[model samples]
Target: MSYVSSVFQRIKVRNANEPEFLQAVEEVFKSLEPVLEKHPEYISANILERITEPERQIIFRVSWVDDQGVLQINRGFRIQFNGALGPYKGGLRFHPSVYIGIIKFLGFEQIFKNALTGLPIGSGKGGSDFDPKGKSDGEVMRFCQSFMTELYRHIGPDVDVPAGDIGVGGREIGYLYGQYRRIKGVFENGVLTGKGLSYGGSLVRTQATGYGLIYFVDEMLKHNNKVLQGKTVVISGSGNVAIYACQKATALGAKVIAMSDSNGYIYDENGIDLPLVRQLKEVERKRIRSYLNFHPEAQYIEGCKNIWSIKCDIALPCATQNDISLENAKTLVANGVIAVGEGANMPCTNEAINYFLENKILLAPAKAANAGGVATSALEMSQNSMRYYWTFEEIETKLKNIMVTIHSNAAAASSEYGFGYNLVAGANIAGFKKVADAMMAQGNY
Candidate 1:
């Protein structure tokens, strides 16, 4: 067997129950055959084995009291996957779906995603099983305090820095940072990336991922002698990533017709009202179905998955992992989706990705396409370290430049390997080579 296949077999056996992690590993390994063929020493040095395993896995019990005065216990985890480039960096997701396997999957993906940005940050992921959906502010704050009390010890400004994901956002980051400050008694702003502007938060951080996804897509289109202008875009999810993707795409002259939430999706043929989306989501924290209250002319779909059936020039699945199934991919291709960009990590399943590739749909993989968030997070870290901030225009420009570079690099790598613009393989090869070289240079830890 080839080295890549051999290593992946072992990973599957060891992580048999971890389907998400297994899927992530398999996706990455599939693209690594070319790399392994060229660098046989990597196999001898066991770089894949070491890189596949996390440097540290932290699991802790978080005990807190709810608003009803009842004590609640939740599990927290932090998988520091790799740090060859720099400190362990990723996000803390606070959903009930969070588990060891999910954290491992996210952390594993982060290793490459961070590397694609060409940033001096490694990959790690953390989260708790605590669902903050219906929790009161007091309850959430108490839970964050307890969670951070354990997490703070394992992270530092120059160590492992975490931002936000799924359930963790500006509010959660504030609570976590406040607790970390209370514990450490120091103004270590660089320890967190998604803080509020009143504190040390960087401008354009919230819009980075979404804006970055669109920017990368724009670059992909430009490479194919196309542009986002006049394109009909359908983006899944109405959170930070989706919201800003809509904003940026609309600004770039694409008509964003649809956006979604966990509950359902909203379709506005006249293009999504960016301000109203911001109002409904960011301000009111309401369901996407509530969008109809203002834009009565718009259609409200009851199921989010059905949003993929809408015909559009571009499809961006920014919701969650494995959101786009094979059926969704078929529907998109049948409806003539010219391009698909993963705004969420592993949003497209392996089958879905294959269908897209087989149909010759232009695809921007998540690692290279949606890397804007972490890239901006790294920018935030730099500003925090310098105790200074850049203007929104300046930060956005830097983010655009980075996304363009990532797209070009992935395209170049794909062309070099004769993949004919297979960004999936290109991104994997590009990101893995960097981490692999760094690991080799550092020797065995």
Candidate 2:
């Protein structure tokens, strides 16, 4: 067997129970065949083996009191996958779906996603199986404090910095930060990102991922002799990424037709009402079905996956991993999708991604497209280190530039490898090359 194939087999056998991690590893490995062929040094150094194994896998018990004063215990994980480029940097997801396999998969993907940002951050991911939904504010605070009490010892500003993901957001970050500060007895804002603006948070960090997804999509479409203007967009998920992507796409002259939550999706033929969406998901924290209360003319679907059936010029999947199946991909192609930007991590299945690329749909891979949040998080780290912050416009301008550079670098790598428009390979190669070289320079760990 070839070196890539041999290494992949070993990983699959070793992580047989970790289906999500295996899927992530297999996808990146498929793209790295061409890369490994060009750089025999990578093979000789055993970079693949070392990169596949995390530097440290930390699992701990988080014990907290519920509102009823009953003791609740949850499992927490922190997999510092790789730190060759810089300090380990990723996010902490707080959802019931979180587990070691999920954290490993996310951390593995972060290795490339952070590399694609061209920033001085490495890869790590942490979270718990603790569901934040349906919990009282006091219960959430207690959980966050208990989670951080164990997590703070394993992380620092220049060690392993974590931001928000999925269920963990500004409120969770705030609660965690408070606990970390209380324990350390020192102000160390750099240990976390996604903080409220009053507490050394970057101005545009909240909207970074969604806005950056649009920025990358705009550049990708522009290179393909197309524009987002007059395009109909269907964006899944009603979280931060989806909301801001809608705002920016609408600003860029695209009509966003559909957005969703886990419960359901709302389709508006008159394009999405941005303000109403923001109010519903952000302020009200309600299900997407609530949209029908204000706009009776719009249609509400029962399942979130069915959002892809809507006809649109661009499809942005901002939901969770494996959200789009091959059937969804086929439906999108039949409906005339010209571009698909991923605003969430691994939002598309490998099969779905292949179908999109096969049909020449301009695809912005998740690692390259959804990197805005982390890139801005790294910027937050820089500001915290210097004790200074930039204005919103300054941060937004820097973010747009980074997304454009990522696109140029991915496209250039694709063209160089003779992969043409296959940005999946391009992004993987570009990110892997940097991390592989850094690992080589640093020697074996």
Clashing pairs in 1: none
TM-score for each predicted model, relative to the true structure:
0.99, 0.99
lDDT of 2 by residue, 133-249 (tens): 889999999999999999999999889999999999999999999999999999999999999988989988999999999999999999989999999999999999999999999
Candidate 1's residue-wise lDDT over 1-445, tens digit each? Answer: 8767888899888888899999998888888777877888888789888988999999999999998889999999999999999999999999999999999999999999999999899999999999999888899999999999999999997899999999999999999999999999999999999999999999999999999999999999999999999999999998999999999898999999999999889999998888998998888888888889999999998989999999999999999999899999999999999999999989999999899999999999998899999999999999998989899999999999999999988988888877888999899989999999999999888
Residue runs of model 1 more than 4 Å from their true location after superposition: none
Q: Which residue pairs does candidate 2 place in steric collision? A: none
List runs of model 2 lying over 4 Å from the truth: none
